[model samples]
Target: MDQITNDLKKSLESNDAYCLSELSTLFSDRALTDGPHINEDLNTCYGGVLNELHNVACLNGNEVWTSGDKDNIYLYNLKGDILKDFQTSSTSCIQDIAVTQSGQLLYTDDNNRSVNIVSNTQIDTLIKLNEWIPHGVCIASSGDFLVAMTSVDWDHTNVVRYSGSTEKYSIQWDDQGQPLFPAGYTTKYLKENKNLDICLADPDARAVMVVSAARKLRFKYTGSSSSITLKEPFYPSGITTDNYSKILIADMCNQIIHIVDKNSHFLRYIKNYNLRSPRGLRVDSKDNLFVAECYTGRIKKIQFYR
Candidate 1:
């Protein structure tokens, strides 16, 4: 508590990018970290969710698919039963997951060595990393493939799109020959909707940068603080989209999740649970919430209210 805050303060003062990145994300979720489901008391303030998970994904049904630290991939029913525990390759760790538009399976690892394409055939590929480490992957509404990329050490991040047989690496915004995030940020998610590839950028600059699927910069949200200054953390991660065309971001460091409308208005928040660290938010066809609990290593399901 106090120790973590003080440590964070010191780290921020020195401009340690990783710690700063962590802090920025922490404050963004502070709005809900103290909800009853999170702290059990309004006065007892804290940040983050109540669970842990290595990775998480939502299926067409209310079910959730997750990987625990125990070297097992489990498909869970709503009642939390192990419906299936399909053993993956011994050393293949699950990092990111994306389902097809028709509800099939696709996932990528941090190493970018493989992309799992699921079916009865269970096809998968370890895409050789020629330039960057893979952070997130998604199938756009139009069925294009988009991969979120970053330097191995998290120095630079970008979104690259593959449509049909043509591939384009994005510059600043999504156009070719444009400069990607100049500050060298790590982009965690690419969400496609309404024929647009939406990039949710989580840069070390402590803000959310939005860009088109083609990698064009749309807008940037550094996030606002209720306090007088922007000292609160704002490392935005685990991005998902809602029905009304809003974006949901997991403010990891603060233990809260924020919902921003398509117009980017700060909407209501979900602070009902204590999160150690939440990342990789996913909304199913029904708009149910699923998140990867980074620190404790468990994936917990969240019910959404309109």
Candidate 2:
């Protein structure tokens, strides 16, 4: 694993892929957990992975990890066995979670009020809200953190970066620096591309906006019909870019996973009638897709080839 990640970094340095500054931030030293595993224990909870999975990450000994509307994060081994069950002490439901390059877990609740760190033993509050609400959290390859936030007062939303657990940069409705959207924008999800770029799923704007490794707008990619536009299925809820450079979008309304090229070419849709309100989606090292069934409280595992 070290050799592979190092090779990826060297390739970035050599411009083999994109510069390290442009790809997603997966630091050189931090690894949450390793390998892929199935999670059969979840089957009883939602009738055989019914496909409403909310959030999934790699942690503990499992190749797969996930969290639901409930206040628990699950770590499952590669074979789909449950490992550690990290509970939130209190009955707070976590909406999204991001694993840093340092193997640190950071997340926010559905209400987007505070941020917490999930460890082997305890859950600690990293940041608190006197008024503002924090929505999503992401980790840069260099170990920095990017978070999506919103205002408690209005429809305003923004993104910010932090050093470790401290605020380093913030974006608001100021003429000085506006994020991918203005005040009305709501950033639901955030992830780092292989090139270290930050990809955000903004359902309101109905697009996937890209911020460079340096946190600058690289581009915004929407789906295509005859010419390349984000039309009906444009309401992107959950998003992830796979190893094949395909963007997998969870069209919550459409009940399918839409795959497009980096340039937003309409590839193919992974549609299954069973998926319901898939608010979160993730890909394991093996390229198998794990979806979080948001409403029904289920996690669906779809094998790419199978």
Candidate 3:
């Protein structure tokens, strides 16, 4: 761990973007060389109901949040123990969950077609669109909220930006005036890269769409056919970006997590880690990865950064 910290410090001192990018690959190689092994008994969190787990997010250093198919969202310790659970007052499945800049919890209320925010002991409606249904909710690095929304027919999908309840921006079309994303109800999970680019996982499209901070089309990453780590017909689900701009995508069909750089270049596959249907992913502040498995209802904590 000390070595990894020192390497990152040195890379930051150089102030070179290329050096930083190279460090991400170095981290991946080190983990692979050391034979990434899951400390099964030590890192697994297993208090969720069987086959009920849906999504997960890192709330803080000590707390990880998970939502199930029911109306409950649970907070658990790093070890396998339930700390607490909250009922959203609606029985519909919570599509996604995220933590706000002020330490508030945010989630998609699919039952009401709105984005809900939990602050202090009160859950309030943060953004409620009239005709649009919210799927994924994320707090941008700039402290604003980014939500993936779609129409009822799922024929149109786009991301909406909101500063509290007021609309700020909308990202829909590409640079050439084409639809930026394929119409689907599932292309929602999104995160802001270290460079402020928007990265989203589209399960229906089997691709990850990356857009510039200015809402311009940057690149689209389909799975690499030549790579042995990643399989074809990529069905990406939950997506996240670490502090180093490395994107972690959950491939549900392949049952593996693909790590990529800021440019959407393939870095490595986090395979052979005993993962089954990894649906939700979150990298904590200490670079510890928390993965939620849909089938087993377990959250696995891994030390990939070291």
Candidate 4:
């Protein structure tokens, strides 16, 4: 394992993509939990009324909102009490959900390719696309909606910004006019880092793609290489950013979360505590990490900071 780690480090330093790919393929079958795990323990695990939770959003660091395919969106308090249950517009499935700075509930309807907001009076469509499907939704620091959308064939993907139903900016093709992200149906979860850069997790590409505040490509971080051979592919699902600008991403297949610094340096893996297919991830203002375990229908609130 030590030798393999050393080799991976050398390969990374040399920018050897072929060597890294071969290493990943060779180790992609060991039990995902076999490697070194973090020592942090989950503060609480809440179950009941949650099934196939696809995403989570935190409001004021106390209230939590969970979305699923059950035709309902759930809101819960820190004590695990269900505060509200709001019905969705369709039964197909809610692709993603987010909480705006003003406390409004915003979500993407996958079946309708629409973005809606739950206001004090009613649910209304903020925007609807005819050629693309919305996969993930988040509120930027500037109070605009950052939505991840892809074409029907999954041949093209883009991050669009909407300011109250009007298009503001877009991030798709790079400066070279080439596609910036791989095409796929996988949901591309995204969030704004503390420094205002957009951090995106692309499961199809098995990598995290970062874009600068000015909408330029910053960097792309693939799964970090390790001495301990891995048994499965690096499938990043849910993604969020902490106050420190650390990017935390859920590795669904690997059953772990990868933590990366602001500059996109691989820091460490948060494992242990028997995380099972962890998905929807959010870091509260207090730095508490909330993880949604998909298959188990449970939410694990963990304290990653001392």
Please report the candidate that would top TM-score against the real structure.
3
Model 2: how far residue 262 lies from native, Å: 3.1
Error of 3 at 287 (Å): 1.1
lDDT, each prediction: 0.57, 0.63, 0.76, 0.77
Global CA lDDT computed for model 2: 0.63
**Model 4 global lDDT (CA atoms, 0 to 1):** 0.77
lDDT of 3: 0.76
Look at candidate 4 and tell me the lDDT of residue 305: 61
Off by over 4 Å in 2: 1-53, 60-63, 77-82, 89-92, 102-104, 110-112, 171-179, 182-187, 226-233
Task: Tell me the lDDT of candidate 1.
Answer: 0.57
Candidate rank order under lDDT? 4, 3, 2, 1
List TM-scores for all candidates, in order: 0.70, 0.73, 0.85, 0.82
Q: What are the runs in model 1 whose C-alpha is more than 4 Å off?
A: 1-52, 68-72, 89-92, 152-155, 163-178, 182-187, 195-197, 213-215, 225-232, 296-300
Q: What's the CA error at residue 169 for candidate 4, in Å?
A: 1.3
Residue-wise lDDT of candidate 1 within 126-161, one digit each (tens)? 355666766677776546677777776666666666
For model 2, residues 218-256, the per-residue Cα lDDT tens digits are 677664456333335667888876555556788776676
Per-residue C-alpha lDDT of model 3 across residues 84-161, encoded as one tens digit per residue = 777897667888999987788999976688888887658898777777878877887658889988888789888888
Task: List, residue by residue over 1-306, the lDDT tens digit for candidate 4.
Answer: 537645554565432232221233333322223444332322223333454767778876677888765768888876777888778777677888899988999989878889999986389999989999998888875588899999977899989989999998788987889988788988888997755678888999999998876666778988776634446988899899876667899998889888877677777788767898889998776677888877766677777665
